[model samples]
Target chain A: MTEQPILEVKHLQHIYMKGTPLEHHALAGVSLKINKGECIAVIGHTGSGKSTLIQHVNGLMRPQAGDVVVDGMDLADPKIDIRLLRRKVGLVFQNPEDQIFEKIIGDDIAYGPFKMGLPIKEVRDRVKWAMELVGLSFEEMKDRATYALSGGQKRKVALAGVLALRPDILVLDEPTAGLDPRSRNELLERLKTLNKKENMTIIFVSHNMEEVAYMADRIYVLADGRNLVDGTPEEVFVEAEKLREHYIGTPDTVEILAQLKAKGFAVRQNAYQLEEAANEIIALL
Target chain B: MALPLIQVKNLSFEYAVNQTKIPVLHDISFEVKPGEYVVIIGHNGSGKSTLSKHLNGILTPVSGDVVVNGWNTKEWSSMREIRQKVGMVFQHPDNQIVATIVEDDVAFGLENLEIPPSEMKERIDFALASVGMNEFRNRPPHYLSGGQKQRVAIAGVLAMKPDCLVLDEATSMLDTHGRNEILKVVRKLNDEGMAIISVTHHMSEAAQASRVIVIEKGRIIMDGTPREIFQQEEELKRLHLDIPVASQMARKVQSHHHDFNGTLIHNDEIVKEVVRLSQREVPVI
Candidate 1:
């Protein structure tokens, strides 16, 4: 939507354990551009390089070949500070346990700000702000034992920890992977607020078609480390046949629409949400 | 002609902290038949995972008992026998995979059971093939995809020839494709007479099960076929659970077309109903 993209990846390629029997081409010529304040989703089957691509965005892994520029800063530049780059691009792993090590919720959230060498008062303020932003009440959860919290609560703590750094670009790998329906909904809502009110650039990696359909303004499909498709949710999801070939699935609404068309119903097979599909079916009826 | 593979009777479990008891599972009772595909659906803290642990003797119930293949879980002497009859696969595949090589990991459980080398070879071959991981048998567990690793984990469980498999959100951490891969294996195993008790939050996956059990606040709140369970979408939503997409779509269509009678648990049924409605001669107001 803008001349300068917030995130730009060009001809990215990565190989794991290169030049060995276990060599794996994790990413192959993957390219994408994310505009500022956009909610972008990277979807792929397992081993399709979704994780590999996101790691490059935050400098967690340097690009083997190709270029990745985040907010106008080329990640390949030798002079760029890795710490500053990571702070600007928040990366949340699939498992919250992997990132959250502090016993107390407040302590875990404050770890990022504290490490950034912020003043103690500012660190505390950011900790409370981050917790509240993720829907965790600071007063109630500050002293709560991290281990005692539910899976969703723990995930929120992990998100809060990253948010405490006030990263401009928030990237999450399967943020709702293990969450129940309610928690998933609550977290998505919170993210939507952040994307809208704060104009945060969100780039999430997920394989959940329904969640992608609901949340993503744009989607990039990866298969075996290669970029397969990229478009709006409706545009990408309508290619149910194409997605299936790569072991990727579209949202249930799109699948149902396809099924209806296959069943000789004169209905548009393009709906990505339940209400839209229902409207299309009702119109046809 | 055969008894249920798992019979949980008046099971109650609680965790103690600082002399205060916190109830986890409250008066839970259920039975899983041989070859039955049973999906346990619940929100976080609903005690679904705790109940799964009770089935395999990982945790003894505070009161009552779990009888697996007529062996009571409460009896300390029957722990090994119960564990043998009921194998468990956890959410994280990384945690479950032990050996470096795929075949070695599959053979880990067999070796623990003191199985002979000749028999172990046959069992491992059968197990790996059943889960469609034979191609990656020689590959390293660390190099395999998440889906492949989980299948290897399943193959490990299968090598022991457990009568039932308890997947404690095993597919929750996987992408959509990985989830389907594991579910396909589980369905195939169930069809071949391995009773399955899968604790999951994926409504679509739950809809494929022969039976669905809804857990809430440490109790078994609803138990029925997928159709019966999904029909009560409102009730499920109240409990922080969701109905499958097809069912949700059917509800939306029904709002306009009152006579749109349809069995809406699966995609095919919804398609058929949409076709029927399109062909109907009645003209709505």
Candidate 2:
């Protein structure tokens, strides 16, 4: 990649319970190049190492025999200042309940900045900005109990916690996993703003192909702990059958086209969404 | 008289948060038939969750009857029987999990019932196999992915052998892979004759189920098959739900080409339908 990627995962291998018979090859020779401001979406079935792979980026999980290099700091290097790197390359987990620790929303948002030993004024400023960025009102939500917030609010607060650190690269594991339509759209919009305005590079791991198709510049497909495929969403989803054989459902548009074609109907396999498919149908008529 | 699996007659509930009993659900009434799959859709604060909790008597209704297999939930005397018959799987897997080991957690419900040792083993094995989690039987719960852990959680309830399963946004916490995995299990269970009532925000996912119920502001707006519910796309949009991506694309193209054939909600159908029509001697166009 040009000028060395912002985040380079080189020959990364991770084995759970290594040496024991119960060991799993969570990641097998995975190497990826993520440049600044690029958003990459990783899609796979459950137990396909999507989460395991992301965890390795922030020293959350160390590779068994390889390294995760972010901005020249080798995560495998014991002497590397992990705390500094963690602050810069922040990780937001899928479940908000486990990640958010403090009682109040403001306190939880400021946890990361406070840990970095920032001045009180700066930490407070970072927390407020982070809260507003996620679209949580500062005055109303800040003083409220964290437990009082709805499921969507908890997620926004959890994200604010990570954003307060001002991480250059953000790694979110299924960030919109269970949000309703409005909340999901809001989160995606805010993320887009961050990527566009702040030049933040993002590695977003999601299972929703539509979201992946809409958001990512690149897509990675994982299966059986192997990097099965890698390309843009457009390129990756074109292989509808292969996607199905791997147990990853092709977006409805792709599947419908494949089915129609198999049943002696003429349709393009690459067409994924319903609207396009409809237009194509109408045109044929 | 043949009793329904679960019946909520004019159910209303309020949560006293901050000493304020906020009315969450009002005048909710429905019945889940034995061996039926019913999908519930609504935006947040639409009382979907509040209603789900009342299914298994997790939350007692304040103003009406929640009858489970002919037992009134307000009378706590029969709660043990009600819980045994109406098992639930919550949205987040981590919160509901009680044991560290996968198999042990799966056996938790059985242990509470004091199932005989031999019977427990038999049930546990069958449950694990049913959800396709037999291999991870010995692994710890913490190590499993959100979807896998959810399967284990399902196994936990399957071992109990409930008459109906209520998944309250269970798939929301999962990635596409996880969502599909759980959906497969849920569908299979429904086919095998267990009553399933799933509260979800995914229209595509709702399309897979036998029946769908749409609610807004704690009132039932529509109840029908996916075809019927989705055909009223304009209404769904009003409730902040989205049409499948393919359908939207089809609609978009239709605005340009009125000659396109068929009801296009997904892409492939539109393409095949189009090409087929265009190829005819007296072309459809």
Candidate 3:
């Protein structure tokens, strides 16, 4: 038997400011399925409904026409508990700084678990674990003023706050948007560890093709509030013309390989990773 | 040679946190020549943003000097003149956009300078056209995509007629399409004799620069042309930075093939090199 999906969206449709002159169709018949322990990436240009699709995952927004189911709980069911669904799926927005509120880092991270009314000890433990996972030292950084933290550290604190809830699925919108190369890499590594070691399901919306290629097990390309294509990075990136038509960018490695293939070098066009592309070219030589 | 457009001498900066002075920038010095495209890259907390802020006197240095267009930023009387000469675009497009309408936003800077209404109208028209936002001049900025909003932001800055444009991670929040849009506009401006100082984490963006500056731990560690800096791949990796994917692929091929000698920073260069070395009939794709 095929494994059941942890989260499923069927013909999801959403419209912003419906019934008004400024109404916009943000999502139109978008559908996707995510298995447990899978790392998925959603890529699209701005205004392509990528954000609207993820917002539906955690019951943040109810579908205007279709259905969303998370862990067998149908969001369309009026009896479904949204708080429970949110606890099972942590969502981090693009600018994590906007989510930070507490003056102290520890206080900010602990806010989530504390709000859940967990035992004091459990809250502390969760906060510590979350901080450690994000590479922030609980001992050294917990008491630091949130305002004083760098852009990267602030993002970590925001992430830790979400992780303190111990969500089985973590959904991020541009998790490394403003981070430097080092911080971006470190965050991707931590997310990978979460998926591999803890079997946590991961879903992220990003504009960075490199990050998507490196971290995603499956890639979904979105456009015009609908699913344009879905496949592995290699498969999706192979259709370079289609992606470029939708204003989607391929990874640099893939671009290099594609250019060489066009020039008739007999290089593999599917190699999206740097080392793999290099090796492909070297073999031809 | 043309005179330096901006000069930073012995630049040092610090922040006061709860009465404790925390240094964020060390003694740093650099000069930007007119019409140069300079990219400043660094890890988080490296004071790159702080340094950019000093360029326009957003943050006065604690123990150094920033002179732009022969006006010292330290002098209160030169603040207006210095700001008029150096325009800054920040990370968040939403944060920087002040007016509701695109054309009005572009006019904000001009009105502040008290330009004659006739000249202001002409400047606004030219600025919007320059960034390719002319069609949306009457549209509300909130409804635009991230890239479109950023173009509007650039248009707003361009209306001021600044000699130098300093972008503090301006494209970090944008998607690939949006980033390309901003880069294209900036490149054209540079070609037309405007100086650019872009602080970015995207190594691909750095590859297009005439010069690259690497900062680490609040200090300027490396300053040279893109080729000069990216050739030392190991050093960049050691500092938690990375070279462009094309450069990395070139190095990987060099390691195994040993004949790929030149430093290839761009994608086409790598493709051309691979085809040249393939020793096979090139097939047109």
Among the numbered candidates, top TM-score falls to 3
lDDT of 1 by residue, B31-58 (tens): 8888898999999889899888888999
TM-score for model 1? Answer: 0.95
Question: What are the per-residue Cα lDDT tens digits for candidate 1 across A46-94?
Answer: 7789888998998888888999999888988878988889889999998
User: Cα lDDT of all candidates, in order?
Assistant: 0.88, 0.82, 0.91
| Off by more than 4 A, model 1 | A19-23, B279-285
Ranking by DockQ: 3, 1, 2
lDDT (0-100) at residue A206 of candidate 1?
85
Question: What TM-score would chain A of each candidate receive against the reference chain A?
Answer: 0.97, 0.93, 0.98
Point out the higher-scoring one by lDDT: 1 or 3.
3
DockQ of each: 0.74, 0.49, 0.80
Ten consecutive residues with minimal summed lDDT in candidate 1 chain A?
A: A262-271
Model 3, clash count? 0
lDDT of 2 by residue, B158-222 (tens): 99999999999998877667888899999899889999999998877776778888888777878
Tell me which of candidates 1 and 2 scores higher on DockQ. Answer: 1
